[model samples]
Target: MATKRFAPTPTPSLLSSFTTRPCCLNTSLRALLPATRPFSSTPTPQNWLTPKRGESSKSRKGKPHVATGGSVRGTTLVWGDYGLRLRSHDRRISAHQLKVADETIRKRLRGTKYRLYHRVNANIGVYTSGNDQRMGKGKGSFDYWACRVPVSRILFELKGDVHEQVVRDAMRLAGNKLPGLYEFVRKGDPPVMGITKVGLVGNSEEFLRRPRVPVEAPSLPHTAQRIPGTTPV
Candidate 1:
């Protein structure tokens, strides 16, 4: 019999040679695969990286943080802001009270020799008996209003018992006289002439009282006496 000459059986390593050449095998397999095969099993893109609570993307990055109680000159109050920028020393007054006081002063001093200077924080500074035209025109020479007023007077008239003593003490410490208008600000008395060197000629009591007037009744004689013997009943 002729000797059997079968092609030598390929070695196991030779039979699996494609495994060692992954690049070549992958290219060939990909070309043969379907184009629409699902590329990945992963889910669609998500917006999970969006901003979370208390994290603002547009936050101010450059401005310095201003702490409370910080004082900056020329800063003004922001209306309707809930008093966030209010100063501790600022005095508060009602709008009605201010209007009433202003009208009262202007009416009383009409054609008078004095002027009113309304200062900040609702305080009124009166130039007592000052020349009306020259009141605020020239430098200080005549009687001018000062911040110091007897705490007693302010409390009695403006603030009542609550602020009276406090104002008085403050005035005393400052060595300043109380506002001249305090004399007419008595609780029971009607408004009186305020402090004025020009009108200081008369005594205070006399000035306060109203001038008296005399009246005469009509003189009529009894008609019976004149009528001859008309019964004197």
Candidate 2:
């Protein structure tokens, strides 16, 4: 005697699709509709990396003074001879970081005749977070403020009869916090030589985007044989 076998039938799924319109279709189509979302999670301002409403920006095409080369302004006969000129060799300084650096230098120059003139401006605003949420939305909310510092752009200049030593100390103190490479050139000093090690040697050699000598900024405050060593304090 032989036994008879039967085939099993397939069950239906909760979701269904049809080529033509049907009176009834399975699954929700709400997701298919377009939704409004921000391009980034961070909240963006009307304008970024530039001056805000009622904000003043000191614009100088070439230099502060044609003859003085922007290194000296206001009090030339007094503290003009001694002042530190900062330029961005590499990297960009954020608005917050710039503030910290400015404050640090100001504190160091306290009770002194040296005055600080800001060259770079912070106009960038950055947003953050919103990654955890579902996709297809927008940029995250604004997280913090920032600014871009271009290469070879003057950052700060100390004006007045500031002693070279004190200015050196102030530069070191300020440079410690600011990002990128900076040289403490005097008012009339020639542009510092860049220590860039670029060309590739072998397969082991690597390429650099910025290519600065050493990432670390100069540590020495000032040389021994410098004028305006220290104030009578």
Candidate 3:
């Protein structure tokens, strides 16, 4: 009677001939990289300047016009003591040109403890007319790309202890490199009174505040675009 000891028979499913491979975490497929597109040499000028008329409020609503130029909204940069600024009295500034100015300022401010900051953001897209295009065809078919600079706006701001002459020289080079005229302004100036302070550190306060300079000074574009994103040394 061997205590009725006996091995129970395996279940039908377990005894089946079907075979399955072991599960493995390392055997999972490799993750894929995100897709990216190359920037075109000539970017098409989409009608980003304005919205097309006749779209329903459902489609056009909640979509604000993209800013081409102006002080960065909701920001009060360059308000710190002794920081210098470049101000535009009229017209909007362009991005390609702004980058040129940024590079020029960096070149001047290099080898210093100072850090340069752009008070106004230029991610806003703008367009230009194609060469020899006829007038009056919806802003000339969006020829080239640029940024806008609003009147009474601060373009670039320099932070930290810096020489006033150095800032003036830097702004002069920057202004001359841009499309339109600009005045170097300093901290604590009355808001946009057409009064720009230049010489603050050394010499006469009045002389430093407003020096004799030409108006409508133009900047020639480089044959090849200057490299953007130069860091301070």
The top-ranked prediction according to TM-score is 2
- Top-down TM-score ranking: 2, 3, 1
| lDDT tens digits by residue: candidate 1, 13-46 | 4335556578977866776679897778897743
lDDT against true structure, model 3: 0.53
lDDT for model 2, please: 0.54
Task: Sort all candidates by lDDT, best to worst.
Answer: 2, 3, 1
TM-score of each: 0.16, 0.46, 0.44
Candidate 3 is scored at a TM of 0.44
- For lDDT, candidate 1 versus 2, the one ahead is 2
Segments in model 1 whose C-alpha atoms lie over 4 Å from true places? 1-92, 119-233
Displacement of the residue 216 alpha carbon in candidate 3, Å: 38
Winner of 2 and 3 under TM-score:
2
Predicted model with the maximum lDDT? 2
Give the per-residue lDDT digits (tens) of candidate 3, residues 1-233. 46876899976443253445444222221113235656679967433333334223222112223333321341234544333343433455555676778889889888888766665544333445667777775443233234454544566778766788888888888888876656666665544323322233443344434546678866657854455786434
lDDT per residue as tens, model 2, 175-210: 888877666655544332222212323211133232
RMSD of each: 30.2, 23.8, 21.1
Off by over 4 Å in 3: 1-90, 128-144, 193-233
